[model samples]
Target chain A: MYIHAVSHYFPSEVVGNEHFTRLNGLSSEWITERTGIRERRKAAPDENTNTMALEAVRRLFDQTAIDPSQIDLIVGATYTPYDTIVTLAHVVQHNLGVPDIPVISVSTACSSLINAVEVVEGYFAMNKATLAVVVVSEHNTAYNNETDTVSGHLWGDGAAALLISKERISDEDMTIHTIITGGAATSGKATTGVMLKPLEQGVLMPHGRDVFINACLYMPKVSLQVLEKHNLTIDDVDYLIPHQANLRISLNVINTLKLPETKLLSNIQKLGNTGCAGCAIALSENRALFKKGQNIVLTVFGGGYSFGAMLVEV
Target chain B: MYIHAVSHYFPSEVVGNEHFTRLNGLSSEWITERTGIRERRKAAPDENTNTMALEAVRRLFDQTAIDPSQIDLIVGATYTPYDTIVTLAHVVQHNLGVPDIPVISVSTACSSLINAVEVVEGYFAMNKATLAVVVVSEHNTAYNNETDTVSGHLWGDGAAALLISKERISDEDMTIHTIITGGAATSGKATTGVMLKPLEQGVLMPHGRDVFINACLYMPKVSLQVLEKHNLTIDDVDYLIPHQANLRISLNVINTLKLPETKLLSNIQKLGNTGCAGCAIALSENRALFKKGQNIVLTVFGGGYSFGAMLVEV
Candidate 1:
């Protein structure tokens, strides 16, 4: 499968480090030093996962000549959902006015975006679908308790859209060389690290240290594993977009992979953790800078502990 | 893909019509007349989606020779999840001691089981996985309002499991010939008919009549569509297991298909609406009686209005 187009949406509301300083009693310098998140985007009260997702897809359609009718499959990835049943996928499908097609909403927590792409790949392999649209929206603010001191300030709302094809539709499209996703619940302290309790406590990261340790261990391991499948190495990677959770984690992954600071592309400094939309949003932001034969690796680790890496080349 | 084995689990607690009559102030006769659900299985207060799923998969493993290590993929289907982030799939993987593999939890509402099967089919097509286990569990009681009067009596909790293979592992295995899924959020009254608000209203069916109308229209349509893909019709199907939402809905579907009442297999009169687990539980319950050369059509219509049909041959 190939990535035909990519687009992203972040809310207009800018939340700076000072906001967390007042709410959680943490100093602005401390927050910046710990997370490297100087500021992040927040969705408005009326904006939600579905709305942001719709906006992202509309942006994709506006920028590209691809018509909505041509999309045979729609996959929505989100861990924070406004409505779990009428899911983000269903709402997007309803608003797009697209006729009956498979609109599946999938989750492996924050690794959901990669899983969503895998779903599209599956549809393509079975001859069930050709042109597929993947919309990833995270409405963390809707579910995150802003007053919680633990991990409240870490979340930011965002959405991204990607148009993919079974075959390369244009020379501009990037060939997706591999997608490798796996569960790590058996790994040390995975189940208790990070959590989202939609109806009860909202989002919480009680074991942030364990999560950080596991993420640093997995992201580089999976990235290298996927590269091995294509007989490639870290040296061949032109860019690396790790999950936008913590900047320190990104640096740790790149260091382990022996990639230079310039090769690591991160938006967590400006966008915080956008969940499934994080890496995709970063990909959209940087896709224009890519040259032919340039390789980009997107790696992720999610709460409840799912990890994946996707290798795409222009 | 071929189905190697099937198993299910329903809590021992039986919730009868009298319980609803007392809670919702609805007469038992009226409830039975409308839904044909005299009594339904209910999970205990402590039992949730993941627990029920674990039981279902354990039963499956006990009855089959497949080891946990042999499973390459675990796909869990649930609209009523115990935890949205850690997910039923992750918890199942955690407890089973299964090492890292793709453990995906997917939702397309009550049609989730068929969609999960399609996901496994996709993996098989891509050669990403060979032996797959799909667990569908719905803890509707955890989110349903017993005093709501409208849909309070319509929910029951149960879970089912299926072991599927990329190749025909045994002569008794049923070959999955066709799997078709589509979104119908574009259809009339879809968004409003039935909804699950995990953080707010729980489960609500404010527009039951509209859902009934659409369910009647889509179930037989998708069933016949899947049959036509394989150059077969209603005559070729030996059994029809429609979504176990309401027995009246099942009758209407069979009536539209012109299949004999005896060919219609329904557990709704006993199990209630087990959400995503409904049809698969019905399939597992009746699979022992299926003769060689027989065909079974499992068709479903779900809230948020996703629909699908799968045709399997013995």
Candidate 2:
């Protein structure tokens, strides 16, 4: 499967640590030094997962001439969907005026986009579809706790959309080659550590260091596995688009892989970690950095101890 | 793709309208009349998606005599997950001691299990895996508001697992022949009169009447499409296992198809709507009813406006 175009959308409202300073005695430097996030976009009360997805898909529509109706499948990847039963993908299809096509929602935390891509690839390979659209959106701020400096400063709200098709324009048009994807629990205790308790009314409590260590270790190993499968070395990869979990984790993987800084792509410095939207946001921001025949590696680690890697040739 | 064995896990804690009447002002007859759910199970506070899935998978393992490590892929179907990230499939793998494999969580609401099965078939057809597991779990009660009679009485929690493989055992074994799947949606407009807020959390608000109409019209049509592709007719089908959405909907579909009641397999009267777990649970409950060379039709419709139908020969 080939990625035809990528786009992302962040709400206009930006919230920085300064705003949290008033609610919880914290400083911008303290938040930035630890999480590497200066400011993150916060959706207005009226905006939601569907709205964010719409914004990104609209830009994607503008970038490509492919009509929404031409799309054979729609996959929406998210964790914080507005409803637990009704998927945001259907909402996207409704907004796009293409309701008859199948729309599937996938949740793999930050790795959701990769999971979505994997499903799309499987569908295309089986001749089940010709064109597919994957939209990853997250409103983590809705689940954030202002007093919890660890997770509060590390998350933002955003969405991204990518169109995949079997009709490749060129052999170098960034085809998804292979993926090594799975997850494991390191919490030792089953069910206890993985549970997220609601705080006050809507706050989300997360174990940051646990997630951090898992991402740092699992991502590089999976990326290498994918690379090895294609008989390609790390040196052959032109770019690394690791999930925007954090600058530290991404940097650690890059260093461990011994990849140069020029070969790495990231936007977490400004966009923060958009949960499921992280990888797609990174791809959308770095779409221009890719050229025909260039190879790129995308890796992600998210909740449920989920980590995945995909190798694609541009 | 061939189904090796199927198993289900129903939570021990059964909660009927009698239980609801004691806790919240409600009646069994009222609940039954509105949603056709006589009773539903609620997992203990300690029970979750992963544990429930593990229970079902263990039963499958016991019956099939297959080691967990031998499974090449794990497809988890659910909307309510313990974590927003990381799929519950990995949790099952970790507990079962399975090797690292490509695990994904599919959320197409009620159609999720069938969607996962569709994915499994594609992967098998592509020679990507020889053995795969599809686990569907839903914890709707966790999100249901006791005060909301509409949804509270309609939803249930349970899990089911199906072992699928490319190695067909015998002509007597059930095998998927064809799947016709897709979805449709309406813009969230008051004028559409196709929207209903069923939860105070406002996550999965759906118009029940609209969904019923869509299912009644699309499900049988898709089933016929699958049958036509396979050069079969309704008379050739020995049984119909429709998604356990509602008794009225199922009965209406049966009437429309003009199929005999003896040819239809149903468990909604006891299990209610278990979301993604619906199809697997129905199959497992009625396994003995199927014989070799007998054809069965599985149809589903759920949130995302997603609907699908598949023809399988037992």
Chain A TM-score across all models, in listed order: 0.98, 0.92
lDDT (tens digit, per residue) of candidate 1 on A1-314? 89999999999999998998888898878877888888889999889888899899998888678788888899998888777788888887887778779989998999988899998999999998999989999988888888888788899999999999998888899999999999898887777788886657668899999999999999999999989999999999999999999999999999999999999999998999999999999999998899999999999999888999999999
TM-score of chain B of each: 0.98, 0.91
Q: Is the docking of candidate 1 incorrect, acceptable, medium or high quality?
A: medium
Range of the 10 consecutive residues with the lowest summed lDDT in candidate 2 chain A: A190-199
Write model 1 residue lDDT over B1-314, tens digit each, in one string. 89999999999999999998787788889999999898888888779888999999999899777788898999998888887788888888888888879989998999999999999999988899999999999988888888898898999999999999998888889899998999999998877788887767659999999889899999999999999999998999999999999989999999999999999998988888998899999989998889999999999999888999999998
Per-candidate RMSD, Å: 1.3, 2.9
Mark the regions of model 1 whose C-alpha exceeds 4 Å error after superposition: none
Which CAPRI level is candidate 2?
A: acceptable
Backbone N/Cα/C clashes per model:
0, 10
Off by over 4 Å in 2: A170-172, A186-207, B19-35, B169-172, B186-199, B202-206
Whose DockQ is greatest here? Answer: 1
Residue B108, candidate 2: C-alpha displacement in angstroms:
1.0
Cα lDDT for residue B170, candidate 2: 47
